[model samples]
Target: MADLDGDFESAESGASETYPQQCSALRKNGHVMLKGHACKIVEMSTSKTGKHGHAKVHLTGIDIFSGSKHEDICPSTHNMDVPNVCRKEYQLNNIDDGYMSLMDENGEQREDLKVPANDLGREITKKFDNGETFNVTVLKAVGNEAVIGIKCQTS
Candidate 1:
């Protein structure tokens, strides 16, 4: 019911008078707003039951530190809120061509990210994975890479 882009808040608003807050993960049948959570999208899949059934989005994510996997079902018709902030925890897979390749706990490729050492401070070559270690920060997504602000360690 909140003001969204233009007045297209609901798909059935033109002829219907009621709005449902929850939606199904298939056939785009439901709608709801979501809040931000520190997680990364590890995998995504889509499917449908039959010709008359709706489509669904299967999403898999991993907790940045705990490395626990989280799954969700999102309907195709659902008006989900894409979080403005993106966060990820990964291991220093390797560095090449002024870019860094990181392997997330889920073993997903989060690569080709160019992060400046000065931005991370202290020549951060730490190995973090399998509950060994991890870092958290707000990420701004620009194209394929993310711009992160590393919190400076205080003495």
Candidate 2:
């Protein structure tokens, strides 16, 4: 019985650190889960063609945290958290063909750059948005892409 208790603790501890396996339970009704390495709200659009023709919103975010981005269509009446807490300034050191080197705030150098445009579901990939800082939610070093869920910071 002691061994069983120990195993239960270990399993619960591990589960605590990772994201929930089932994505359906994360968001509320009318909201669909966008998938990536780490998913975020990409876009949410709605039309008034139905019987109610209710208002809708288009939400677009990145899942660079999970190395992906996705789009979802939901009613515009919903509210969501636009989490940008992972912002740490990084410097563009070098660009080799398609790859770019990024130096983070800690001065840690990371290579293996893949353009955000190459992301599977990412639709918009403008040239590093002028003066916009990008956060590397997931990078390419661990068999993922160079970056994911990159967006410009406001204030």
Off by over 4 Å in 1: 1-36, 49-51, 86-155
Q: For residues 1-155, could you state the per-residue lDDT of candidate 2 as single tens digits? A: 35554434323323222222222223322223343233454444445546866455444556544434566554545433332223344565555665667787688997765545554324223434343455544432112343444444456
Which parts of model 2 have CA positions greater than 4 angstroms off?
1-17, 21-25, 28-37, 41-89, 118-155
TM-score result, candidate 1: 0.33
TM-scores for every candidate against the unseen true structure: 0.33, 0.34
lDDT against the true structure, per candidate, is: 0.47, 0.44
Q: What is the Å distance of residue 108 in model 2 from its true position?
A: 1.3
Best by TM-score: 2
Q: What does candidate 1's lDDT look like per residue over 1-155, in tens digits?
A: 87766865546324322233323331221212222333356666778765886687676665432346666777766654442334565555565666666666588876666655553522444432232334434344312334354333234
RMSD of 1: 15.1
lDDT of 2 at 155: 60
Q: Where does candidate 1 clash, by residue pair?
A: 23-30, 25-75, 26-55, 27-54, 27-55, 28-77
